[model samples]
Target: MILTDTHTHLYSEAFDKDRDEVIRRAVDNGIERFFIPAIDSTYTQAMMDLESDYPENIFLMAGLHPTHVKEDYKRELKHVEQQLKERKFHAVGEIGIDLYWDKTFLRQQQEAFRLQIQWAKEYRLPIVIHCRESFDEIIEILESEKGDDLFGIFHCFTGNLEQAKTAISYNMKLGIGGVVTFKNGKIDGFLDQIDLRHIVLETDSPYLAPVPYRGKRNESAYLINVLEKLSDVYGRSKEDIAKITTENSKEVFGV
Candidate 1:
């Protein structure tokens, strides 16, 4: 069974001490494919360090995260462009509207999101989005900016059925993570409605850890919990869920 962590910030400081061990443990347990998302220029060096350490198992994505969109967003975007020109990334990602924290820079966030989406289109690469309490607003931008080439994952998808369908219409795959394992993380009841083709597995590690590890730091090995929960929801075995989601990820990342 091939399992893919389509979205994870292995570059985060949370894993500085045991990052290699965490990845090694996950790989031993069959969580091989890890697609890393870029936050801002702040973590570019850490990301490069991680990719250098694990070149075969890890892939990188470049973009400015929405929450990181501040007064100097233009410079941050320039940094993103600079990195893109210097290296090849699997996608332009972890970019989208994040209105959950503060609504101060909503306009800037939208602008950055649109611009990054345009970059993804230009590079012929998929994108990974981080939508937080801004699905309606995001839909508006996607409707306007999304073209034939715009495609990627809706990282940490917890949206409703209609939202899922709408994102699908925009060629976005739902990045399923630990939320599905939460007692109150309500996507499971309707997840069966979403075909496996539009879904991919992710851990979003050191953040939304699955049940059992809920409230603690998440890791790639804990992806087994997400996969197990998915099997229960889809009425399939863990191996089957792993195979299908891995294939679906390959379809999106083309790896």
Candidate 2:
């Protein structure tokens, strides 16, 4: 089974002690391809270091995360643009509206999201969105930006069937993660209704760990737990789920 963790922050400081071991464990368990998302300018060097260490396994993206948007957002966006212009990236993402942590920068967040989406289209690269408590707001922006040129994965999707259909209408593949294994995670109820082609697997490591490790820090190896839950939800074999989701990820990341 070739599992693709389409969204993971393997460069996070949480794995400073054993990042290599964590990666090795995931790879050993068949989580082969990792699509790394950008948070902001601060983590760029760390992300680059990880890719240099594992060139064959890591695919990097460039963008400023919504939660990270602040008074100096234009500077952050400039960094994102500069990075994208300087090198090749699989996508322009982990970008979108995240009003969960704070709403003070909502306008800045929307602006950052719009600019990044345009950058992705300009580069002909896919985008990975990070929507938190602002689904409606994000959808609103996406509605205006919808077109054949604007399409990517909605990372860590936890919306209803209607919202899922809406996201798909904009050509996005829903990124399912550890939350699908939680008892309160409602996505499990209607995930089967969403076609396998419109789904992609992600770990979102260091956050949203699956059932057994629910409150603990997540790691890429735990993606297997998510794969198992998805198998149960779709009534498909784990191997089959992994294969299809990996393909879905490839379609989004072009890797």
lDDT of 1 by residue, 1-255 (tens): 778999889999999899889999999999999999999998998998889999899999999999999999999999988878887999998899999999999999999999988888888889899999999999998899877798999999998899899999999999999999998999998999999889999999889999998999999999999999999999989988899999999988889
For candidate 2, the lDDT comes to: 0.93
What's model 1's overall lDDT?
A: 0.92
**Candidate 2 structure quality by residue, lDDT tens digits, 130-174:** 998999999998988888999899999999999999999999999
- How much lDDT does each candidate structure score? 0.92, 0.93
Inter-residue clash pairs, candidate 2: none
Q: What residue runs in model 2 are displaced by over 4 Å at the alpha carbon?
A: none
Error of 2 at 173 (Å): 0.4
Give all candidate RMSDs, comma-separated. 0.8, 0.7
